[model samples]
Target: MSSLEKLTVDKRTLKRIIRELKKWKAPATVLLSLYIPPGRPISDVASLLRTEYSITDNIKLKRTRDAVQRALSSAMDRLSRMQKVPPNGLVLFCGEDMETHDFICLMFSPPEPVPVFFYRTDKWFHTEFLEEMVEHEETFGLVIVERDQATIGLLKGSRIQVLEELEGYVPGKHHKGGQSQRRFDRQIEQFVKGFYKEVAEAMNKHFLPLIEKNALKAIIVGGPGYAKQDFLEEAKEFLDYRIRQKIASELIDVAYQGPAGLRELSIKASDIIAKNKYAELVKAIEEFKRHLVRDDGLAVYGDKMVRQALEMGALKFIILDEDREDAEALAEEAKKYGTEVYFLSDGVPEAEWIKKTFKGLVGVLRFKIA
Candidate 1:
């Protein structure tokens, strides 16, 4: 929900693909090969648009292994030139090792890049056939600002998070409405202060259940008016440190509910965020640099810090900017170990919505924070 998504294919395209995949009622077994080729092909590199091709024919998934390999080789040859590979370069395997079921052929060509579904890879989603499987309920979140509101779309691997809206009380609502020169008595002013404080206290009470359930991940502060400001001042003592940090940006919009304001907030959530692996990690390090007040080298940069995080268990979590480029190694490394990851971009309606829903993006830490 916090950036890391692109609506590349329109609804029509998606509908068409869905229809086609439905028509593809094969045995659910597909051809698969790791064709090594005749001697590792003495070429520098080849631009065979890499992808997982799911070809279905009137043939058996297992039997077509050889023919599929040969066809792939042919396709590769037509696209790029190569030297010598092995006589029987590729090997055949079965089961989970072969993710392609009902496969006619599958290859990891780098040329044709199909966005593989890696659930939670960016935000929330895994690359799997959702057709036969029941679709899980998405973690929908909402954020309300004074002027606007927003709603978040659950992505690949998003957990069931909470969406909360805290409304602060403004005291003058119950008083006389006309142009009566009204001056508040000391008792009345005291009552107003108590009223505002009570409102804040009530909000805390409301969130107690959610916190107990741990259904929230982040909280976004937004609205057209000063509700967020008033709430922050009143609830400062009860606020989480990470969430306090997440309150840096203020919304200039107006809305009655968080979901209403989420739409406008998303527009401001797009900048300086990345979704791609190394780029996302690197961008976080860069932003992390700004938060370093003492700069005692505890706050550092480059692959060095990342490597340390990966090794010394310093990476409690990784923040990715939504505008990231390609990098597999860093993502893979994170998965190899147990580390939390998030992707965020500015100017997206869901960005603020996500923070509001989850309470803010802080995770279990591997090391102490400064």
Candidate 2:
């Protein structure tokens, strides 16, 4: 299957599955993880498992042999039921937790095609491949440029990473008189121009590949004073046209110029980062807040109120912080009522607000529910 294919499974569900699978453990390497890519013949996989099952007999310990064989049998049984591989692909995790003696056979038609055929026996289910499929692949380039210092970063998913920090020596303003002052001014201009080129080089190095991959959605630039504008103006000559064109139109004004400034730029560029996943989440929270401030019956929060709203079929949309104890259960319940569900990460301030003020779950009702 093509890597460009959209994931067939919901991201939340995939994440939940990964979390659940990660918790299961075995004392020995009895856990089995099987990955069958799209277009592979199920019969061939069944045969392979049968062969593996026969090979398990060579195990020295009877207990280990029994566990491995049972897992292989379970995997074969699952394949026997499937007529063919799913469009995206098939993933099966069959294992016996030796410590608990509890068995699990989980199968998934992943959100994306399984990259290759793989099988493993280990203490835990191999979920790295599935985890990759759920990762937020698209990213936004963040650039904070000032005269003396600049920071370049990437906003990927809900996290921000500082890629490079550059410092420049553009000596304090010229205080001398006549020829000396003019020379100093000329030297300062050269230093500023050189600094801008260095920033451009970093931007090109970091953002160009993302652009080529079509993963970079846009670039946001910010800084204090006219330095940002000056950098943008001079960037046309030193920066790649592709990178220049991707720069957001509304350059932000920020007080700081390093990691802190990158974050400030992110918060300020909400409008420009419209396509960003975190921005979408923040927007949803803001909408919920608006409803709450107006005292509209449409907004409901806290465990009791949100649960009641879900039960009464009044919920139109809901946002739950994934860190909540019952978040997964609430998400499942919300889905049954046809309510749209959004999962928020813990670090986002808006998400934290919902967690602290609203008990980590909030819903908008389709109609006021008394």
Global lDDT of each candidate: 0.37, 0.83
**What stretches of model 2 exceed 4 Å from their correct place?**
1-9, 136-138, 141-217, 220-320, 323-343, 348-353, 359-370
The alpha-carbon deviation from the true structure for residue 72 of candidate 1, after best TM-score superposition, in angstroms, is: 30
Model 2 worst lDDT run, 10 consecutive residues: 1-10
CA displacement after TM-score superposition, residue 67 of candidate 1 (Å): 26
lDDT of 2: 0.83
Q: Candidate 1 lDDT (Cα, whole model)?
A: 0.37
Model 2, span 1-370: residue lDDT tens: 5332332456667888899899998778899999999999999999989888888989999888899999999989878877878788889999987767888997768876788999999989999988876664447899988888999999876568999999998999778789999999989999999999999998999999887755677899889989899998876798998998788788899999777888898888877775455665777778888999999788888888988888998988899877665665676677677776777866567866777877778888899977
lDDT per residue for candidate 1 within 1-370, as digits (tens), equals: 2111221232223333335334332222322223233344434223321332233233465544444444444445433432433232322111121334332222222111222212110111122332211221112222443311222221112222234443433344336534442444444445544544544444345444443443333344455567556545755665455435433354344453433345444444323112232354445545444445445434433444555666666665554332233223354455456655555545444455434543333223355544
- Which ranges of candidate 1 are over 4 A from the true structure? 1-162, 165-219, 267-280, 283-370
In model 2, what lDDT does residue 329 have? 65
| Top TM-score model | 2
